[model samples]
Target: MGAAQGDDQDEWSFLFGMLMDDATKRGLAHDELYFLSDELLRFSLAYQGYEPLLEAVADGELSRLRFMHEIWRAMPEHFYVDLALKLGAELLAARQ
Candidate 1:
């Protein structure tokens, strides 16, 4: 689902950097930042090469949340909701 092998590493790194920048700018806590960063990296990996998908996500298009839900569903069975909840909290705090 990700980019061709090695190319994925760069994409992941870029996504992490984006999340870190966003989290820092939003004054998010360390744990929240890490959780959001990881989730965002997963999204980036899942949407590799789909510039339209990335743009839709960045612009918060209506489907963005659905896309995230799909990514979460498609992720490994071991993935948990705790991280998502934490990120939600951070987002709520940021909006307040």
Candidate 2:
């Protein structure tokens, strides 16, 4: 990968780590977080529109929470519901 691409990936990784930390605090299981983070990475890679937002987050110009909010807003409702259900199921399973 080019230096810029590598930089973006590093930034993305940093942002993903922040998100995973937040999700862990909210009680998301490791497996669920893994799947969610993977999905998010895929989404960001496939969508160029999110590059600017990711760049902003990486540059420290935007809060991670705001980055999440923007991503959530952009995600389809059905997609969000599916991930939510999967996460909830994992949480319930973990509790048992």
Candidate 3:
């Protein structure tokens, strides 16, 4: 269910920017940064929710927010900072 790489980059950039802006203002600690990021991710997933009933129809089919699952699976402890770092690395890797 992943969007195109170009699309994900643009969207992720906006998300990362917004999260960083608030994180900077709050002077959030490591733990708090992740807490805020997780919340933001949750909100994004909630906003994207559309196929609630259809998601579970197939056994192997991905549910909602498949990209999120990808990000989380790549992250350390599912931290937001880690997500950014990993996503950045993935972007860089894509270029090579």
Candidate 4:
């Protein structure tokens, strides 16, 4: 597969894993999980720059529950411009 296609697959995996982690922790029923996933998709899009969070439902990078938790913990309700700028650098470094 091409790099772009691979990246899309990875993103999908990650999003799905996150949804499952949240659903399991909250003891969500199947229908509830579907509803909650929609809410989370909005938040994930605005926070992570990923539209349609389902695209990352299969992301390999987000394998463990810890990864999902960490991502949530790292985000705040509102971003501070200065802090975000600094954290952007840190994020780039961490990704490497």
Residue-level lDDT tens digits of model 1 in 19-79: 5567668887433545444366455546443345446656756243333333433333223
What is the C-alpha local distance difference test score of candidate 3?
0.46
Question: In terms of TM-score, how similar is model 4 to the real structure?
Answer: 0.29
Which stretches in model 4 have alpha-carbon errors above 4 Å? Answer: 1-7, 35-96
Measured with C-alpha atoms, the lDDT of residue 7 in candidate 3 is 29
How does each model score on TM-score? Answer: 0.30, 0.30, 0.28, 0.29
Clashing pairs in 3: none
Compose the digit string of candidate 4's lDDT tens values, residues 1-96: 347553243455466567776777889743355444445555554664433223444463332333333344433334555688889999999999
CA RMSD of all predictions: 15.9, 15.3, 14.6, 13.9
TM-score of candidate 1 on Cα atoms, chains taken together = 0.30
lDDT of 3 by residue, 1-96 (tens): 245433243455455455655656787632346343445455544544333322442242532234333333322333556678999999999999
Q: Report the error of model 4 at residue 25, Å.
A: 0.5
What is the per-residue lDDT of model 2 for residues 2-54, given as tens digits with 9 covering 90 to 100?
46553254455566667767777988743445444545544654643466776
TM-score for candidate 2, residues paired by index: 0.30
Q: Highest lDDT: which candidate?
A: 2
